[model samples]
Target: MREMNYFIVGDVHGCYYTLKKLLQNWDSDRQKLIFVGDYINKGKHSRKVVELVRELQYRYPGTVCIKGNHEYEMVRYIEDGTKNSDIKENFRNTLMDYDLRNKYRDDVKWMKRLPLYYDDGDIYVTHAGVNWLGLRKFKENSSWCVLRYRGRLKRMSRLQVFGHTPTESKRPEFNKKSNAINIDSGAGNFDNMSAVLIDDAGKIRKIYTEQIRKEDYH
Candidate 1:
């Protein structure tokens, strides 16, 4: 119970309603919230999701977020303009509601400011693994395994927690290493959401769910 003291959530994937539900009683002054990225896309409420994040930033002031590949693609679209493969249309459409079409490009700039890595004395967090090697022989820096997984897991300094690679299930598995936890069980289209919390000792505790009938689940 005496641990990381923060309740960190994983890629919300535009499920603002779910996030709101999960965040009930969250007190910023007591327990901090760390969002592991991918707060938008693939769900129907990207604007709502982003707005919640914006408001939280204002209210909480020192909250933390990491850069997910989705946000990276968003930066690319803003910087060099979109190509056919920036991301999916539905996702872009969701963000379009936020009017990220240049005049509001600052939102993307804000997103891009998120760092590729973080170490919290007791944990490391990222959207993907840290490919010390960048995008050469290994997968691109955008891949979850590198930008979200490695940067946090490879070291013994702290527990690593992340999102980005959607887990197929909603249960806790052994972290990639004894010290890292992956919590991105897809919240985009599923009835379940997932997360990981670390204790002061850097031990991981999983917060997850099982599929229930949609009627009973929501």
Candidate 2:
């Protein structure tokens, strides 16, 4: 296997320009880029962001992409044309980010294939934090467990890294007691996009980002 350093990026939303700026100096050969989902909605250029992520995975063999709630909604919309107004509104917003909203079936299929979580011994990457309240009852394949759980895990074996609930400071939140880290810096909410870099020993090296503002895009 190739020696690789993992860099997990939080929700990108549709901030394509900001994400592009953050990846300007990334090295695909020696590093693995893992995205903690929510790549669409709330900003512009959702299509480009998805395209870029797909391109990166193609170029880098070890790249990993986790599924987010937004993706789940997309899959539901495609499969059943769900009647939930909230889901419909969110999916519509996501589609509007792309010029070709009518042709998003392929993206829905791609999201459906994405794994909910990834485990690499030292660290665990998921879209949202695991349900600590019900470890014994937790189902690995449960969409609610992977996409909606929020609280910290009670007895996590490895360092849990995730991005779903945005931090108040618009930065990655780390709790040593729970051994959990939240990296969703609210990029979907028109804030900054953050990347958490970790080494083989499970040490977080740095957290960096490129800011996004609604005014600038407007």
What C-alpha lDDT do the candidate models reach, one value each? 0.63, 0.78
The residue-by-residue lDDT of candidate 2 on 88-197, one tens digit each, is: 56557666555333575677778889888888898888888777775532353464477767665655777889998999999998988888888998887787889988
166, model 1: CA deviation in Å?
2.0
| Candidate 2 regions with alpha-carbon error over 4 angstroms | 1-3, 83-86, 97-102, 134-144, 213-217
Among the numbered candidates, top TM-score falls to 2
Weakest lDDT window of 10 consecutive positions for candidate 2: 135-144
The segments of candidate 1 whose C-alpha lies over 4 angstroms from its true place after superposition are: 1-4, 83-87, 131-145, 148-155, 176-178, 205-218
Model 2: what TM-score?
0.88
Each candidate structure's TM-score, on Cα atoms with residue i matched to residue i, is 0.78, 0.88
